[model samples]
Target chain A: MNALLEISGLTKRFGGLTALSDVSFGASEGAITGLIGPNGAGKTTCFNLITGTLPATSGTIRFRGQDIGGLSPHKVVEHGLARTFQAATTFPAATVRENILRGALLRHPLGLGAMVFGGAAARDAERKARQTVDEVMEALDLTEHAHREAGTLAYGHQKRLGVAIGLATRPGLLLLDEPAAGLNPDEVDRFATMLKEIRTRFGLSVLIVEHHMRLIMRICDHIVVLDHGEKIAEGAPEAVRDDPKVIEAYLGADHAK
Target chain B: MSMSATSSAPAFQPMTVVWIAGIVLAALIPWFTGSVFHFHIAIMVCISAMATGGLAVIAWVGQLSLAHAAFAGIGAYTSVLLVTRLDVPVLLGLPAGALVAGAVAFIIGAPLLRLRGVYFVLITFALNELFRLIMLDIPEFSGGSSGIAGIPKISLFGVTLSNYQSVYPFALFCLALVMGLLVLIRRGQLGRRFAAVEENLALAESSGIPTAKTQTIAFTIGSAIAGFSGAFLAHYVGFISPETFGFQLSVSYVIMLVTGGRLALWGPLVGALFLTPLPEFLRGAVEYQHVIYGVVLIAVLRFLPRGLAGLPRQLSRKGGRG
Candidate 1:
């Protein structure tokens, strides 16, 4: 399968600590890719680098043949790459529908003059945005909470709203950071189903950073394991699970024996 | 399944009618009493409201600008110079002031906005002081400490608005234009972008909204409005100096905005309406004027944190609970 997102030799360093180093992976078009590791294994840092939240120390992140390593976050989004945060980041005061509408409008931003004058183009864009918002909310099962302030929604609903926001941007690649971090087992299962449905429905690729082994193993077509800021194993879910390097990384050196 | 989809249609609310009626009554006050003082007060209210309305725009993007009055000063001087030096029409000078102020804001906003929260406010405060000092240095164009006096009155289509009564109507017309522009912006896509940027910068950027550009746009538009208001004030009051658009003036605009509603579309206007005539009403207790303002501000911040424009909503919410 063709790579929707391709990263190679990616590295990120703080003042004295290397958060991610020489890490490389590809999320294939229309496939669910998983990035898993122990805590502080640099999974989130990898997402940050790909999404342009932080500049790569040294690397190339090519999305659809365009280099997007150091682009601003919004510029990255303009290239059809969007992301959801680990903590369900949202415009807390805005309603869920409004939050999604904000993302939807990004696909069809009216000129400032057109926006103020209420032209036909502006009206058309507004209609399209409303439709996208409605569809995203329905897909995420958040239609019932559409009018509630995003911050006021239940934890699981807020997480779903985060994905809905990412989906509304019409991205070719969606990066989810710790999406199942706090979800209960049942909720995680529901989320797993929703992820698969959206993959087919939206025709988009997903790169999910997760700690839940079951969800990753069940849904991901490919799994890449990282340990101490380096890729330790890469393969199909079962093969990666059986890899001794990944086992040592997850369960420590003694457990691998 | 689409809850409140039809809520987009304009719904008749009793509070909306009440607000309109109250504004109409206030607009007719000078005419009813035939008081020149009342007309003067009304005109000042219009100017204050218009300037504060500009500050409200900057506030919407989640930045507090202490240099707002400096932008107004930039506008005031630009208009005064154009009218006096080149024989430009006062009508043309107004928009010229706005253009220059907006241009200045566009130039400075990118660097200035890099600083957030109190740092942004502090830098703007220094900029305001810098503006006053720079103008003071150029006494020839700025008229220095004593300032320019006996400026031309506002004239539209060769008819001068020579008295407070005539200027009051013109001021009202200008205020209406500014307020109309605010409404148009608030109801549009740009408004949503502004709200998103204000609410969460990181989320807005990640969602494909250009947060920096959105903030600069708000700053430019807001400063332009301030410029126009400053020009109008220069012509109406017939005197201006660096002192006129000083820190005190900027603080007053901030007070009006915070007291009115930082986020409400009508906050600036409501704030100006409630605060402008307050000093006049406290004529006998002149020494206590600022103290009263302090008390009112504290009361509003505590009780109606959304400011005066949010009063109806607050009252209704309380009533709902009962």
Candidate 2:
């Protein structure tokens, strides 16, 4: 399958500290790719660069065969790439439905003039947006909590809401940042199953940044490991799990030996 | 189950009727009292509310601007010059003022909005002062400190509103138009976008909302409204001066916005209604008028953090629990 997202020679530096160094990977269309790394392994940095949350020091990020590097976050999303935050980021005060609606509206965005002087087109767009929001919420099991404020949600639900928001954007490629970070074992299992279900249902390509090895290993079709901002290993989950480089990165070199 | 609440349809509530009645009664106050002074005060409220409405738009995007008064001044000057010099009709001049003010906001907003929070406020404050000094320097247009006097009154189709009563209705009409526009915007998709950007800029951006552009749009609309109100004030008051739209004017607008509910659509109107006639009532203690204003502002901030417009919501939330 052709790659939905391609990153080559990606590098990010914060003055003296290099956050990501010449890391490169491609997420295939209709497949789940896991980016696993230890704390400070530059996994989040990769997500940020891919989503245009931060400017890359040097690299090219291609989405759907077009260069999207250095574009604004909104513009990157407009290119059919959307991302969820490490934390369950949302419009805290807005209801779950409202939060998802904001994301869904991106699909049927009305111009300032069109919004102010609304017509049939605007109404149609809004109707379509609401439909998308309903579908997204239902798929994410957030339909029941639609009226609840996102900030007031339970921790696991909030994480699911984050994914719901990303899905609402109708993205071809979805990047999730540590989605299962704080979930309990049962929640993680459910989340993993949901991820797999959504991947096939939506026909989406996913690049997930996660430290939860079991969850990542269970769901990811392919895995890439990063250590000290560099790609240490890349292959199927089983191969990457046994890679000495990945083991050393997760555990210390002494522990690995 | 449906997201119909996100749509613009007004859900039936008893409070809605009470609000409409209150507004209608307030609008008819001048006629009820049969007093020219009441008419004048009512007219001032309309203009102040309109300007404050503009400020509220900027506030909606979670940015407080001290340059609001400057935009108003830009409008005032633009309208005054257009009418006095080029012989443009007052009706046309009003919108001209809005256009110029909005244009200025659009130009500066891209760079200016980059500075968030207090820094944005400080820069805007400096911009307001700069506007005053520069206008003062250009006495040929601004009439120096003494200012322009005997400006023409608002004339529609060659009918000059020569009296306070006539002008009051016209001002009310203009206020209604401005408020209507505000309502249209608030009920539309742009309002949702504004809410998203306001609630969380980062999330909004990632959600494919162009936050910077959204903010600039809000600023432009807000400043344009300020401009229209400033133009109206110039024509009705029949004077133009650099000091008219100064730091004090901006601060008063902020106070009104904060006192009413920074994020509420009716905040500006509520603030203007409550505050404009206040000094008139406190005429006995004229010297302590601002001190009283300060106290009221502080008390409101302390208790009604969402401002007066949010009072209903706060009370209802409390009621629901109790």
Candidate 3:
């Protein structure tokens, strides 16, 4: 009831190495929550765990206070939690419109007859896809490239399309991993404004993983710092940045530097 | 996928459409051509296209299925067995064969769709051999290696079409229907979803396109087409041997698709049109016709990565840059 998503004592192990252990976090509704850490901080592994790309070794993930652990990846999306990848995951050959339509395929739970023949359910899906396309394209300023192959877009546009695809599933909670990872400063500024507008318009509770200090500090309401697969600090952005453990995790020892 | 044809290759050229039209036209062959014997071979190839279209789906998704021939065999045998044993009408038998084939594909897809890359092709190749063995091992149903003879031709409303006259147009019509369905699948929401799964399963899953479900749909559709073709094929020949839908048939279907280019719908048609006639045309040099065919496909693959339909676009890209 207090959170849209609740994870308790989550553990993930790959053979001898534990990628994540005893990790617990809760995400509230309609707020931008930032998860930040140094490289190899297990930020992505956590994303993987919540999205069910990798099953938890042991733990509980509850969405809307209902246990959703051990669900299939597609079912995770169906539960109204969608995620973007750290690496850009745009389909190279499909046009931007097609790339987005694939996301809209999840909006309905229609069966084979509707899927095959484009019955009323299929037509309804198309209508929704077109509307979502118009909305996201305007939000992300990608309408001009809507018909262009996603791969041919500029690197920054490709990154935005990746986010747009995540947005397409109409997630109650959206997870963005490194949205501004490969963008230039100018593009990052533009992305920040777009990101703000998305939160305002869609009313989505966004859990974004970012390393860019400026973007996170400016946009995140609350911040969680991860250090070597451990939760080192969690607080308001200003407080987390000032925390000693956060500084050490990011900067490492001054002597070593 | 991009609408920027950016080329001067007539009005309708952007790779996928050309192949779609080509395969569709393969079904329309009997309408124009006059020779009854030509109709016989063309109808056979058209049936071959149904199975190949299914293979095209598998290959487009970066999966290879050597047991394509096996599914065709399953379809042919199922319908043959049904017609021979149950006295079911040919119309009923065709769907029956397709249903059995689809069920078999569902079972195969459950296990094989999980394998990675070329591992699937290897597994399918083994399955093709296994199916042939099963056909021979079960003599009562399959008639052993001898196969079932005098399998009834496909008929409608009690009208027997067991000859070249009936089977040729029927095969062509079925081809058209299958191609139409494939085009719709490619153009429709599910079609795009399958392409997405083929292009990137991880991205597809993250985007909420059910990967397993989409793969199953594609496999089921592909298998159904294969089985449907087999039913028509059994009747077209008025007899069937397990050998007809075996390794050589699988190789030919893949060759047709590859020579034509895999994603292009027309690829299989062009492949069948050219390859189906070449050996017969050079009957005197029959010993080396297949070698020539292989050499030609090699040249095409090297030069036109998109297949025959891709040549003009590739040339124009060079021409524009030049």
Candidate 4:
């Protein structure tokens, strides 16, 4: 029905450096769409622009047909678009469960019932969060480490927790920057499966940036390649894989430049 | 396993009887001791601790506010004005001053809160200077540099507190009230969201926790508590001076929170108690007390990054992270 997220001719710049130069793309509901590029190709910058973490230099970002440009990051989430950062972002002092609960609790405006007493609302919210945490952990196979301090997790798990926290928001559009960045091969395979589960189970539409080509090629329904801040390729995975521009961007950088 | 929880709420359980024992010990200190002067200093410590606990919210959320003392000044002056000009009962002034402080914090914090990181810090520093200058101009209201005088004592439920003699326990009561609020916030979702914003603002925002709004709400609440403390302190002294609410007072607040542990509810109290007694303890060498305090702070900052209550936990976390 509704195309989940629509970004048209979006441009963002940092001082003189044009980080995202008129990049345009769309991701539909229930599809795993990938944004792939070499380092400094502005994948994360595009993400920042979409999530409203960074103001777009110019152009429109419409989430389910609503213009979401210039809103602060929290407002972006409120509008049903959520994102996972490239950095290992977690409340280091908190347990994995508390981290997820914080995300779940953010859905409410007043947080009235939960804020006051050890009242029913607070307990209900917490129980729901605990259930979601358990389900997400099961899906990600991180159940055993539920009570562990988030900072103590291996890098890959911490990265997944960032995504889990985002998933807890139950966003209509989930933008993930480099979800598979530092994972080993086995972990990447596991994460690809997790991504598929996230999409299917949550009915989520995803826009992901991953430098890990194998994971992208395996799980993505479609792929878009960016070269020097421009969308160089976008198509079904097979066609995009054989793309000469994608090839040059990834493999033949020096000569192509 | 926390040792400072005062309440019995299961979900937000703090350490119970142990903390009560500690509070009981604190209550006996003034009665058991000889010097009224030391008791006065201890009372100051309690008041300052309560105010700094409020300031901790601002500091912990990465907002450095040098205008805490100024907000307290607003509270103190408001209390004085209400008592002197309006002839309001002194008890009315406490809540009135607190409400004004909260209102002022909201007004000032709303605009300046758009400034992040060190910009927030600088704006607050300038705000302290501005507030002092404003006090200077409004001589009719604040009594200028000479400040307000003959401000009456707080009469709680019809019992008029005598300055110095009776105010020790009243000041201590104010300290308890402020800390109790702090403990509630610290154990709740608001506190968690605040900490989340500090850890990763972008992540917090993406998670739909309005980071800036959270900071502003915290600032408002914190400033309100500071005002409440200010109201009590002003009446306790029976006088108010702009100098008492200057930038140095802000630093003193900062020093207390920083030394105790900005993250912990008790950190501000510990910092105040530790530093408040140092001048008296060194007595004849009062001049060197602050110098040594400065050196000690440097040493702690270098070695104990998270303040005293947090040190052992930090080490254990480092071990676990490794």
Per-residue lDDT over B1-322 for candidate 3, one digit per residue giving the tens place of the 0 to 100 score: 1222231124344565655576557555666776776777777677767777778776656677778888888888888888888898989889888899999998778778888677887888888888888788888888887878877767888998856767776777787788778766765667677788888899888888778877877777787778888887888777787777778778778777887778875666666676776776676766776687788778877887888755667788999999
Error of 3 at A149 (Å): 1.0
Off by over 4 Å in 3: A253-257, B1-34, B285-290, B315-322
Task: Evaluate residue B211 in candidate 1 and report its C-alpha lDDT on the 0 to 100 scale.
Answer: 85
What's the lDDT for all of these models?
A: 0.91, 0.91, 0.80, 0.80
True contacts kept of each: 0.81, 0.84, 0.66, 0.66
lDDT of 3: 0.80
Candidate 1 residue lDDT tens string, B1-322: 3443563536445776787688879989999999999999999999999999999999989999999899999999999999999999999999999999999999999999988889999999999999999999999999999999988888999999998888998999999999989988888778888899999999999999888899999999999999999999999999999999998789888888999999988799989998888988777775665676788889998989999989999998999999
Name the lDDT of candidate 2.
0.91
Name the lDDT value of residue B180 in candidate 3: 77
Cα error of candidate 3 at position B136, Å: 2.2
Q: Which ten-residue region of model 1 chain A has the weakest summed lDDT?
A: A248-257
RMSD list, candidates in order:
2.1, 1.9, 3.6, 3.7
Q: Write the per-residue lDDT of candidate 1 for residues A1-257, one digit (tens) a residue.
A: 58989899999999889999898889999999999999899999898888888988998999998999899999999999999999978899998988998999889978889877778999889788889888888888988787788888889888899899999999999999989989999999999999999899999899999999999999999999988899999999999999988887777854656
- Model 3 clash count equals 2
Write candidate 2's Cα lDDT for A1-257 as tens digits: 48888999999999999999999989999889999888888989889999898999998999999999999999999999999988879899889988998899898977778898788888889788888888888888998898898999998999899899889999999999999989999999999888888888888889999888889889999998888899989999999989887777777844656
TM-score winner between 1 and 4, please give it.
Answer: 1
Supply DockQ values for each candidate: 0.70, 0.75, 0.47, 0.53
